[model samples]
Target: MVNELSSTLSFPILIGDIGGTNARFALLTDAFAERREFPVVQTADFPSIDAAIQETVLDKTSVQPRTAILAIAGPIQGDEIPLTNAGWVIRPKTLIGDLGFESVLVINDFEAQALAVASLSAEDREQIGPGAIRPAASRVVLGPGTGLGVAGLLHAQHTWFPVPGEGGHVDMGPRTERDYQIWPYIERLDGRVSGEQLLCGRGIMHIYNAVCAADRKEATLETPADVTSAALAGKDPQAVETVSLFATYLGRLAGDMALLFMARGGVFLAGGISVKILPALKRPEFRIAFEDKAPHSALLATIPTFVVTHPMAALAGLAAFARAPQHFGVATEGRFWRS
Candidate 1:
């Protein structure tokens, strides 16, 4: 299925990485040219995506794009696509008519993240543990931000296929005695605690509050930043424990993905939180937890992990696809729309 949809798209392609909180855009003029990036805009600042594009992209640049390749922070289901954590419901047909584009391709945001994993250079990511990447092996990319996003990249027949899914919502349970204590205080969505419940931006606060509750102490940190700041500063015990436990849980999940995909190429951590918590992730706790799976612990120890350091990794991924769709096996049967 590699390059199945390559012929359907044309340049100059407008690529966007639409997340819950921010929307970033860039224009790809041709296959070999660099992308022309626009200023980042808050998703809430505009009433709709069309308006944001008009004000922030089209109006400012002279280059007119014939197609749009968007990676959104939600599933692409139908004509009306709602962002998972924002108020924007993207109507692709509406965009085609309004913006005079010939095609609009929408995909899950983490698919773009996975694409980034396939395309990023050595300097774009920082190694987290002691494992060498096995060439042409499948890989996993997950990020903890407004929410936890997860995806896998499979390499077959010299093509990279990005597998996008709700891996972040996978079932997460307590293992250690410390986890059992804090698990009770962790927020539950629906009735059970998922990986997202304890691995997102708010998840940091959840861990902090859980730590405070487990110790029968008052929770002082209100936001995820406050907790991370205090933890990084080493001034607050609860905050420090919260970050440590956060790293542990993140490692556990990353390891789970590595095993699930047999991601010998590597497992990448993207999103703002991963970059911010680099120091903590570099510590022994994260790697120890990652390699803790008893039966397959040795296997996990051989799989590398990294933190994606590029600021606009999603955009870079989209640009890579826009530049040469033939290199990626992106399934666009239902996701692709044309005027």
Candidate 2:
């Protein structure tokens, strides 16, 4: 009877999608077709991911999962990775031993997010411009939010594989006289400027300052939300120019990414800013800059672009990762993998 009851009780697994500021939790209840099911809890309510899982499982029901998967913000190299913006240092083996789980998988947050793009259906995506999608070609996923995130995916043997990278740290170059002027202006504040410098939330303010400096106006540092508010109200010229320049740079970077990967499958723009400033992205200058890649401009025009509307798409990728056996290849003694 005990064996039958154990078989009947599904693997109430634990899954999480963590970022700089928050860690989201979900419960995968069933063993069969479990990834399709959605069970989530906000990270703000709990102090840590482990605490969140423990409290959630206890409050919901008595189901102990033998396996857990957590996707966190940072590169996965060795056993420990300090979260980009948080103080916690995640050690895979330590957590696994502490939790008494048979298996625990940790992956790059952006890689986990990339895994979901191909898995997402038509309903989850929205068109940003006119371009064709070549499903067999390489696809690029770049987002500007808490930080600039980049990842690439290749489709092979009817399966999608994610390639994690630190493309955000790539140097930012100027393509025009205006961009040239802005580039040097930003250089004054930063000795070595990366795309993340002007592509993230703080990046909006940097662009705004650059525009202000170019116009020989006094610059005032402000938060991303404040600048967006002022721009939406049409009350601040600096904020207005900031958004315009930001969109243009976004287009340029997207084009560059497309060129780098020959991303014929598609180029997706994600992050909190894209969704918040959807109206601004519709401007002519934005699309024009996106397609203005000099000789390769023609190729850029043919590549499809989009903004993922679903807030929980990354979590969906976490679910997909949990379902894929290849994601967790060989188990090791300490924490690192050999294959």
Candidate 3:
């Protein structure tokens, strides 16, 4: 796949950022040109990847792109790409031929996000902690969206490398006594506690339910938006508490990912949930939880964290790769693509 796709670097390549709920597509026509305007299409509205592309992209673009790269919300596994949260699976065997593209490169969404970090400016993100990104240093990107996505980026010899993994599924524990009390209830649902169990959008509902259960209260929230709305309005104390715990748990996982990747370049947070719950994340509790790792407490404090606000970050990253494949250390070797 590397040899096949790597040799096709050209102008006007199709670049897409796909997730469980939304799909965004753009055309990168030049090395430094701004990402071409694109639209956000609902994932549920389209039955398959090719259908989504044909309706939202192919019919709209006049460039007639022959090559493409897509950043997906799931693992880019062999033959088939399985989305962890949505009911979509990308089968490369019949996909490219159907799309009428010469070849296509598929990658993890967070990996594309990690690639976008290379070109991010101050205005592109909001800082949550107190450290700066070191030039050419290793950085990590993670987000709580339809599910939690994690990846690391490193630079060596002018090439940005993306290390993708299912880090969100790792077993996690609580820090506070309140957390201890509520975790038992959450544990009953999943049998095991992973970061995604209580950090993503549905995770917010889980935390809200657990908090309500521990307080012997009823759950009024049915979705993540409801939790955020009720909490921000101060209409529901349980929702407020749930968002607080959500930040702490997210901070914990973000800090852990930073440590695992030695993300001295900084940690970039993405996802729909993170953006919607910005107020809770800005509180001191989030920072405290992030820097709470003892012994390395001071070390974690030195790593900066930010919330990605750019809607097209993953697309931008994929654009960078489509512009110059040699500029990234992306895991594409031995990867397969059908045409």
Largest lDDT belongs to which candidate?
1
Q: CA lDDT of 257 in candidate 3?
A: 86
Q: Is candidate 1 or candidate 3 better by lDDT?
A: 1
Q: Taking the tens digit of each residue's C-alpha lDDT, what string does model 2 give over 279-334?
A: 77877666788899889888888998888777887878767655553442212233
The global Cα lDDT (0 to 1) of model 1 is 0.93
Scored by lDDT, model 3 comes in at 0.81
- The TM-scores of all predictions, comma-separated, are 0.98, 0.85, 0.94
> lDDT for model 2, on a 0 to 1 scale?
0.72
lDDT per residue as tens, model 3, 1-339: 334456765566788888878889987777777778577888899898788888887788777767677788887668778777777887766666777676667788888888888777789899996988798889999889888889988888777778988898888887678878998888433478888787788888888998999999988779889989999888999999988888888888888888898888998888777888888899987889888888798999999999999877888778767767766766665354646
How many pairs in model 1 have backbone atoms within 3 A of each other, for residues 3 or more apart or on separate chains, i.e. clashes?
Answer: 0
Q: Candidate 1 residues 58-106, lDDT tens each?
A: 9998888999999999988989999999999999999999989999999
Worst 10 residues of 2 by lDDT: 330-339
Off by over 4 Å in 2: 1-10, 31-61, 187-190, 218-221, 326-339
What value does the lDDT take at residue 180 in candidate 3? 87
* Ranking of models by lDDT: 1, 3, 2
